[model samples]
Target: MNPYLEIHPEVQQALAAGKPVLALESTIIAHGMPYPQNVQTALEVEAVVREAGAIPATMAILNGKCCVGLSQQQIEHLGQAKEVWKVSLVDMPYVISQQLDGATTVAATMRLAAMAGIRVFVTGEIGGVHRGAQTTMDISADLTEMGQTSVAVVSAGVKSILGIGLTLEYLETKGIPVVTFGQDEFPSFYSRHSGFGSPLRLDSAHDIASLLHTKWQLGLNGAVLVANPIPEPFEVPAPQMEWYITQALHAAAQQHIKGKAVTPFLLKYIAEHSKGESLEANIALIKHNARLGAAVALAYRQF
Candidate 1:
């Protein structure tokens, strides 16, 4: 295992100086959205971290090597190129074996973030149990990674499209903590609340940093789930988004969409059905998480 990870020059200096560095995933750039906008959002989120006084480390696997931070050209390539694998922790070996271009998912990015010594990651939302999981057993690898990785995942809570309530319960069963930022209610990605109470809430990034530091000191492994809500002004009405989600999900089921294809399919349906509002909300929330994650990373660095 040649773990000779390559760090972008700026990220190298930042890490050397013990500066705050936030780990970002590449799936959003490659598999989550269409081109041009994908790359544009990627760059914009990086800029948000930079502006927030922390360095950004966008993780991906390019040409069989783990890239802890991407170059401008690499980002451009990821956006324009097709066939990028949505590499999870288990898929790393397969991706490397095939020497293929791959975008790291939350699970893959968290593993790489730990390997690169990053403490925090920001994304739209973590994946979880799919709807009606009792029979299908469909679950995201992210749940398992959270049990093993020593990193904090910041998001606008779980996407309401999934089994949000069940996902939280699953995390609890795995002994992973689900804490919300400044609120006790778990956010529902597009909405402010998932209609359920969060297990814990911490208002400040400093406080969240304390939780991470204390957990690591106690020798407990796994990551923290920070449910940072989307900005209110940008949030779509839950009722409205729900209408869009239901319609899209129904379309996906009618098409027999399964496995990895489900998310993209549903997202496309929602995007078109909502007149592109869904993607707009997705982009807004992601940028918001980047800023929050960067702040938390900065706080942790000071500690």
Candidate 2:
């Protein structure tokens, strides 16, 4: 009878029990990884969340409504479908009104997660100000959404391809706290160190949850970005990824690629040029982030 969302029975049960539930974005299935592997990684991430004692809710847009948790068949189809729309916060109205199929980006996912009463969201990276944003005047809607939404986003960090320094500054200006887990440095998506100090660091999930609790108790809007670095063995060396990023940026300039097309193109180029290391690191970090996200949700439940 819920017109706004198609809630999976398992997720509904978890909600009824007051158990922790972690929200997952669907873009990673639709636009992030290759077909079979995308589905496989999605399942693996859910398994990790379950192992951490939280329910997983993968969100997508389907049949003119937000789907709070997709079935495995739907997940597989989303992973392989080339026509899946990249649904962001702005895209929700179109997807709903037009009755189109779509996958939720970080901003959209956060909105849907909150609709489902889910407080924690897991993603490989959250978008921010693009490189050369002063000239391009481009910024992701995710940043603004984080400034106003009440959800906790767990990510490795922003993608290395973006201007992380500006992103951090922008989040600070918007009053969104950026917290890194067990480290002084924020992480690059494909590597361990992003070369910038995190504004705050907490050694444990309980500490992070307490901060989130205090923020809400004080009636502050906006989300907290919890940066959990990928394990050392799983990360690519920073200098090595930098070379690939530089080369990809040059190629983008040569081809005059701009706007949203720029990110996918550069990522694809790096994936191929790095002999698929970027994609491998991506999978590893996503799984790592999912585990941390579920842990955060669990701690939040205790609070």
Candidate 3:
């Protein structure tokens, strides 16, 4: 166990009993959505996980501890607080040492979840190579962490604001398996299709669990990227989403948003400019991922 980690009693029990537990990131609550919606969605996602027969451990940094499994009040505080640091892999030590309120990004959350021995993690979307990474080298630490951590991540695919094709190439270079659930095409967060064929496809949670088990059992370590498409009805068309993403990227550049701040900034910008349609899709996808993550975790437990 990590010296800085504090697992909730329920989560600890689940781990001790070898039950399914899904690790969730706190950045979605604190930095991904606006006020009341953030808190509401966080709780609702947790409910979705429980309904699917897995315990949810929503992780964050609170008062110098890497707190796993937050309370409703704590979730509310994270959603409403104005000063929560958006902690990524590089910021974890500083935030923990300073005793600051911090919301863990995909990278940080995955690392913490691995430390706590949780195997599956759920999130709305993951950060990836920025559109112009060739010059700026602005790749997200999420990719690097996934390359090293043994946790399996279930997301609605890479955020549309990133360079999807390039991100896929990078993942291949890192030896990470990119599997799309029930689809031949890889999804781009807001939409059900990214125009690229999936490198791998699996149709059920049991199948995914089998893959995870085989990979780790054979000493092939590192995370598996499970891309779950947003429900068809909620999907924003790829072309329409690209326009919004372009505008958001311009706005981010104009504001000089860099590093960890860029994602939340771009997400907020798109949500606002799209008249909340994007936000709704974001919420729907996360809840959808929660269910699948739980199902996979449960299946993995059987192995």
Return whichever of 1 and 3 wins on TM-score: 3
What lDDT tens digits, residue by residue, belong to model 2 across residues 129-167? 988999988899999999999999999999898999999
Clashing pairs in 1: none
Tens-place lDDT per residue, model 3, 1-303, is 778999999999999999999999999899888999999999999999999999999999998799999998899999999999999988988999899999999999999899999999999988889899999999999999999999999999999999999999999999999999999999999999999999999999999999999999999889999999999999999999999999998888898998767887888899999999999999999999999999999999889
Worst 10 residues of 1 by lDDT: 1-10
Predicted structure with the largest lDDT when compared to the true one? 3
Best by TM-score: 3
Ranking of predictions according to lDDT = 3, 2, 1
Better of 1 and 2 by lDDT: 2
Query: What is the alpha-carbon RMSD of candidate 1 to the true structure?
Result: 1.2
Q: Report clash pairs, candidate 3.
A: none
Q: In model 3, which range of ten residues has the least summed lDDT?
A: 258-267
Candidate 2, which segments miss by more than 4 Å at Cα?
A: none
Alpha-carbon RMSD of each model:
1.2, 1.1, 0.8
Question: Model 3 residue 17 lDDT?
Answer: 95
TM-score of 3: 0.99
lDDT of each: 0.90, 0.90, 0.94
